[model samples]
Target: MDIWKLGAIIWLFKSHVEGRAGIGKFLTSFVDNERKPTTVVFHGICWNNSVKLHVMKELSKAGIRSSQSMSKRTSLIDHTVLLLADLNCTGTDELIINASCIAQATQRELHRLPYRWLVLSDAPRSGRSSLWDPFLVDSELVLATVDGAGYTMTEVYKPSPTSPAILTPRGTFQHVLTDTRPHRELFRRRRDLMGVPLTITNTIQESNSSIYHLLQEDSLELEHDLISKNSYTLAKVAFLTLNATPVATFTNSFGYLQNGQWTGVIKELLEYNADIGTNVGMSQSRLKQVMFLDPLDNGRARFIFRQPALSVTANIFSLPFSPDVWIATGLSSFVAGVAYYLSTRLIKTRAEKGTVRDAYLLTMSALSQQGCEVQPRHVSARIVLWVVFTSMMALYAAYGANIVVLLQAPSTSVNSLATLAKSKLALGAADVNYNHFLFRASSDPVRNDIAKRVNSDKGPKAFYGLTEGVEKIRKGLFAFHSVVEPVYRQIDRTFQEKEKCDLMELDYIGYAAFHVPGSKKSPYLELLRVTFKRLREVGIKSAVNFRFEARRPSCKESIAMFSSVGITEMRPVLIFMAYGVALSVAVTAAELLVFHANRYRLRQRRVAVQLGRI
Candidate 1:
């Protein structure tokens, strides 16, 4: 019986050992096949206490071993997972736990497994660092903190892995802590001892499938790390607005609120950085940056950095799309008028009076001698003045003739109407001028006879000798017409030598008219008002009139005239005074006229009633 009992116990022991070895082999094969060796280490911590125990049991049962003791030796796990810490965690715990996990998971024989680590803090705050820190320093591992700590890796860590060892002050741990002349020196030293090159992986689980897969496996910790990194990046965006009131809000990668118009914000962002980064495509970046954030809000918010290529193209093309007639012609006319006025005034005052001494005066006197009065100077200067004027006029006329000869005056050319008539040049076959002349001649026999005599087929015969006599010039044919004072003065320079062909001064028929933009005030309007008043005082009637005369004798002749008899010209000096008077008079006169007419009619009815008493 004793021998049998011993045999049973030995047999059971052998079976248990063999079973454990089989499980170990299976676990090693599974880990090797599923989890490839990579620079990044990921781990998961179950939040439920029961779940944590179950996970540990499962790991042990699978023959995966846990470290027995902490050591400064490089042989250890590079990352770690701490489970079942309470949800209420502090910012410091978050930072420390993340750092420790990163160190443990990265531990290895090869260059200390690259010093990077990650912590899975399933609860809000777990004594993650308190539990993991001991393991981290013992293994001579570098750490990384991942949490909502609102701090960067460089801010909370004493030593950054990027610095040199000589500059780094030796501390109880591998990292350094020191106070150098330059504050950065301490940081630089710490960085050297503890810093490790790290690449951040921001996980994004946008779909339920991805989330389900992550929750099902231990590697789901990767998703959490990605989300943390993504959140951190989003927090860096700046906010701005045009008005004090919030128009709209935009979220950056860090989820910060920016208020303003989208276009404005995008423009500002573009000026800062041309490229946004790798995650967002150019089109998506443009949509995020250029599109309106809060379209329904009163204030608009936008992301400014990226803009559509079409928008840029449209902006460039839109600049030259406005009406610019003012610059092309209106402004030109205004400038030209001002220049001409200034030049004419300067010539009249300086050159004409000074250099051309008495030349103008002589011409005026000559005009007066020919029946147009020289008023205010007749008997006072008489004979002596006449003699000096006459001699000067002759000299001036001779000078003009010499200049004309040198320039080959238009009157001598075939282009001249008078020259063509004398040569009896056949007018162009279908010329309107020829038909018009024939029609006029046929309609008026007396005029036709005169025209025929004057237009005889002769070689350079004078049509009419230069004489101071008024004559009626045919329409579209004759060079001179009835004389009017203003017209005569205007044309005198052109026809001084040929009095018979000179245009005569007739009664003022029309005034120069100008049109201005109906919606806006113009400087020209003011000048026109001033000028019209001066002209009216000189007996120039500017009322609208239409003259109708027969082109042929058989046609009827008629004229219709309409005058602005009630409209008074406004004087420059009395603009304000005149405006007031005109308004009052117009209103008062209308009222008085209506009232008086009514009273008169009433009186007549009353008189008729008294007579009807019989």
Candidate 2:
């Protein structure tokens, strides 16, 4: 006896020992009930399914038509007796629910209560399965008002609440949507593979990847959008059952970091330990190690680095021009000043002959927007002044417009893998092998550099998972290399509308697929291949990918705030200004010291000559 069943049996029989609802009372309530139901339905806890089915058979004396299949019993229902067997609930209760029929079946009244009128659960109410298993379509059950200890739940069911499921739940609910004309319990028929189970390895217990659809939250099971879940569901509908085991490594194409006997998920498949591996990333390299089914979802190997920190350099003035442009501007102005001085031929009469002070003032005043104290009398000098003045006016207008834009909506620097690599920010991969994996596959030097740049923490402490790597990414200056779906989950949660721009991604290096370990010789490999093509074509796998993709688009949220620009946003500009002012003050002080020192030295030399003459 498995411990879970033993424990469940102890609790189920507890009511009998306590003189609560016994087998006799349980029998009395079922056969001669007020609402005599012809058909009963059993589902939810499957471990108890075999024993529960036997009990139902004896109660009805082989006369009552019963089924665990929702599709099979749909036609047989009317003033329906819905025996919600293995319903993990506290005690028992008589309940009423309105089931709206499809465009075909009219409205039906469904009533539910245990035959025993007691606690038949494997565990207490706190430990019951959160949501009912199997698809409950177009059916809204309000079990708020019920009698005694029984199942009561307001179930608006579809595995995960898709966007449309929120408003309307109208859809064909059955194990097999296609296959037979007016599909019978034909989906129930399974092929005999000598009772072979699809022995599978997955992190269904811990990972909330949504790929496995194993998330439990707010009493909702399989909460997140999942591709793996759809694949699993389709396989079951195709008469393929999976017996799963939990594992850490989904697959190990790159084994540079991972080691030991318990290696890759592929190892299990290769060893014939697991017939199938769910959530396996498909790669040509991995394909060599073990075979894969048709691709379920091909996730690219991309890097999700921390959004680059906001820039702090404030060179708004210089940004509009390159160094070459500035040099040309200064040279042009100096040449015009020289031309004005020489063209006037004023050096012979000018007191400040050596300085060309008048010519300098002429151009400087025009640039500064102040009228010159002295204007050139020569026609050629006036022409030069006019030309220089006009050019300065045009430049001033252009500079002003650009500077205003800089102060308003600042443009972000380009983000890329090469840029991240050049930066002080180091890289970390969720899986250590991924770095080595990419480098070998990519011959491009830039990609090689990008792959090698993965920060191994200078030791063996490479991030073994995405969650740990993401925490470092959040802190800043860390690029995490992983796939889209997991990274998108973090991006959706951690980033704000404004910070979406901060989220960065690169193209996938390679596509990964769900695989079962085998060569072309394996019979099961072909079975999975056909299923994959059919599932993907019908959009079962694609829908999950599309939903997640729609949820996370390229950042549209404004990084620029709605309010006026704050000092933080202008951090770079302010820092630049402060440096410029300090440099200007220092230069001015140095020039003043040199001028005064030269004058003092000249006076001392003249005094010495006078003393010598005296």
The candidate maximizing TM-score is 2
| Candidate 2 lowest-lDDT run of ten | 169-178
Tens-digit lDDT track of model 1 for 113-202? 223222222232222224333231112222222223211122122122232222111111112222222342222222222222221112
TM-score of 2: 0.50
Clashes of 2: 13
Give candidate 2's error at residue 128 in angstroms. 46
Q: What lDDT does the true structure give each of the candidates?
A: 0.29, 0.48
- Cα lDDT for residue 105, candidate 1: 41
Quote the positional error of residue 387 for candidate 2 in Å: 4.7
Report the number of the highest-lDDT candidate.
2
